[model samples]
Target: MLAAVGALIIVFPILLLLLNAFKSPVDYANSSPLDFPAALDFTGIQTFWETQNFPRALWNSIFISTMVAVIAVVVSVLNSFAIGIGRVRGRTWIVLAFLMANLVPQEMLFDPLFQLYDDLGLLSNPWSVILTFVVIQSAFGTYLLSSLLGTFPKEILEAAAVDGATRWRTLRSAIVPILRPTLSVLMVFFFIWTWNEFLLPLAFLNTSDSLTVPLLLEQLNGERQTDTTTLIAGTLISVIPTIIFFLLFQRTLTRGITAGAVK
Candidate 1:
């Protein structure tokens, strides 16, 4: 009962936003936002697509997020396996370093990073965003996966080694398969985090070619006096791909999360 109530409380705002996005412009102004649309007027969404040219923004977000997520997951899996399962010397210190790194806010990092990239002629390049997200997100992924990887069956690894499997071969053939569901969850997290990031993109991505959905949505939202319906519609539109992606991977995500949580 408490969970259901909490879920509703969390979900109601999003529900309101979604329902209100379809409200006609006049209905938006005159009616309560919480009220259902008398008619599903899609003109706002249509106008938003035409004016906003959402495809470019959507593509940029997708590409950057996907690259960052994939890189983060791959690198993180290796780091976790080395530190947690392999029990490398100073593994504790490495884990501490990653956790501490997350303490420094991205706000501080981007200004210097921007200047550094500016010097290198890399500002506004998607790689800048991709590498930044990969670095930032990988630390957390490594930390989280460390504990999960620690749970790997020692007997299985020993058997693989008895068969003369090298570390790389064991990882590729034995460990990676076991970690797939968890890695899927981690990838989903990294994807959502990178997709929803605003500060670095806002600070460095100046060209319309580089503009992501968040940046574009910010612009559209700032024009509050303009067709508010269109703005709301745009906001809702930005989350559809994310929602779909989540739904598709949620089973793996759930399994990973629960596996991590268990002893």
Candidate 2:
């Protein structure tokens, strides 16, 4: 019941937004906050598509998020493997350093990074956002994957090694398959974080061509004057992909969290 209540509380705003998005502008403005729409009005959605150039923003967000997730997961997996499987010297200190870095406010890195990117001619480029996201996300991903790796049975790896399998062969044949669920969870997390990230993109990207969905949503708030419904519709569009992603990865995410707890 408590979980149900929490889920309801979390979902309520999204449900309200969806309802409002289908409401006519006049109905949305005039209706009570709790009242249901008299009829579904797709005008808001139509207007949003016409005004927001949502397709371009959607494509940019997808591409940027995919790149960030792929880079972060691959780098994190390698780092975790080194620390966990390779048993690198002073690995604990390296892990602690990454943990400390994660504790730092992400916003604090923006100014220095912006200056660096400006110098490097990366401002307004998708790669700029991609690389920044990879660096920022790597700290957490490494920690999570490392913790997961710690729980894995050393006996299995040793047994494989005793059979004369090389370290690379052991990892490919033994470790990666076990890490799949955890990797799925990380992929979901990285995708959501990269997709919803607003500040970094806002600070770094100056061009509309590079603007992401979140940035475009911010733009909608300005463009949507009388049509509050259109703003609601735009918000819904922004939220749908996240909801879909969560639904798709819910199993792996839950299993990953549980796996971490066991460790």
Can you write out model 2's per-residue Cα lDDT over 1-263, one digit (the tens) per residue? 99999999988998889768888877877898578888978999999888777888889999999999989988888889898777799999999988876787768888999999999999999999999888778878888878778778979988998999987888778988888767777887788889988888999988877889899889768663637777888899998877787888788767766865774
Look at candidate 1 and give me any clashing residue pairs.
none
- lDDT string, candidate 1, 1-263, tens digits: 99999999998877977989988899898998878898989978998998886999889998999999999999898899899888899999999998875788878888899998899888888988888889889998899889877888999899999999999999999998988876878888788888888888888888877889899888788775658888788889987887798888877767766865786
- Residue 135 of model 1, lDDT score: 83
Model 1 is weakest, by summed lDDT over 10 consecutive residues, at 252-261
lDDT of each: 0.86, 0.84
After superposition, the stretches of candidate 2 with alpha carbons farther than 4 Å from their true spots are 1-9, 150-152, 223-226, 261-263
Per-model TM-score on C-alpha atoms: 0.86, 0.86
